[model samples]
Target: MSIAEERIDRLHTLAKQAVAAREFDRSREYVRLARRIAERNRCGLPREFKRFSCPRCDVYLRPGVNARVRTQDGHVVVTCDCGELKRYPYQS
Candidate 1:
């Protein structure tokens, strides 16, 4: 893994911890920082970390809490708390 990927992994872990602690704002900050780092390095976030955030609002998503997750029509649809829907296709 590249340095950027490593940083992204660490950030995602921190984000999850903050969200679990009910510190939504702090989680968002971690997400924003991870985004900046990825942008600067021209690398995308790891696939496992991609679905846990709202790109538009920078919210850390917790299914059944602040987000809705559904598998439909061969896609995974993630609806953020802000009502923004993001869809990702099933690889297989």
Candidate 2:
């Protein structure tokens, strides 16, 4: 993977660890920083990492805690606690 991709992957892993430890703010910081780095490098974030945050609020989402996920109409719909909704197309 490219340097930017590697950095993003590392950040996502750290974010997951932070969220698991109930450190949501730390997770958010990690996500934000990762996103900034990706943007700076003109690289898109992988789908795995994108699933961890709300596009609008930019906050890390923990399913069953701060977010709800549902698959509908061939899409994955993510609803954040802040009431932001995001939908990603499903392949199957």
Per-model CA lDDT versus the true structure:
0.89, 0.86
* Candidate 2 C-alpha lDDT tens digits along 1-92: 89989999999889888878888788889999999999999999988788778777677788887889999989989898889988889797
State the lDDT of candidate 1 residue by residue for 1-92, as single tens digits.
89888998899999988988889999999999999999999999877677788988897899887889999988999998898999989865
Error of 2 at 37 (Å): 0.5
**Residue 56 CA displacement from its true place in model 2, Å:** 2.0
Clashes of 1: 0
Return model 2's CA RMSD, one decimal: 1.6
* lDDT score for candidate 2 against the true structure: 0.86
Name every residue pair that clashes in candidate 1: none
Off by over 4 Å in 1: none
Worst 10 residues of 2 by lDDT: 51-60
